[model samples]
Target: MFGDMMNMMGKLKETQKKVEETKKRLDSVLVDETSSDNKLKVTLTANRTIKSVEIDDELLEDKEQLKDYLILTLNKAIEKATKINEAELAATAKEGMPNIPGMDMFK
Candidate 1:
């Protein structure tokens, strides 16, 4: 029983190490998302910080349309960045445990 407990502790430590490494790797990643019409675009880091925003001259011709497009594109970029970050976190969680018992308690 003592040996088993020690082994479990060792495994948990290793998993924690891996999780930290994965987070560091994810921090260095950046995702770029562009609008479908290509009139607006945004770049975001995995941590969801906006790196840059770009708007085409054609889209700026109409003020109302330009505003709408900018909002739409920004939303899309944020959503994409959120999904990517979730995926990375989920992957790390999975690596820690395939299915954690009573995991709902944490939530």
Candidate 2:
């Protein structure tokens, strides 16, 4: 029993390291979103950090329209980044989990 406990602890440590590495990798994963007419675009990392925003000259004419476009496009980009971040982290965690009795049910 003691040996099994030690092994499980080691596995958990390894999993933690892998999770941190996965997070760093996610920083480079980019997600892009654009307004319907393509007047506005946004890019974000899987970490949900905004990378860039591009706006068309026409959008500059109306501040309200630009605000709306930025909100819509940025929200979409954030949603995509969140999905990617969650999925990647989940997969990494699942992959590293130590197999134990009845844990298959969670998988």
Writing each residue's lDDT as its tens digit, candidate 1 over 1-107 gives 68776776777677788778877776678878888888888887777788888899998789999888878887877787778888877777666652335664433
lDDT of 2 by residue, 1-107 (tens): 89998998899899899999999999999999989999898999999999998999999999999999998899889999999999999998898888777787646
Compared with the true structure, all predictions reach lDDT values of 0.77, 0.91
Off by over 4 Å in 1: 58-66, 98-107
lDDT (Cα) of model 2: 0.91
Candidates' RMSD to native: 3.9, 1.1
TM-score of 2: 0.94
How big is the positional error of residue 29 in model 1, measured in Å on the Cα after superposition? Answer: 2.4
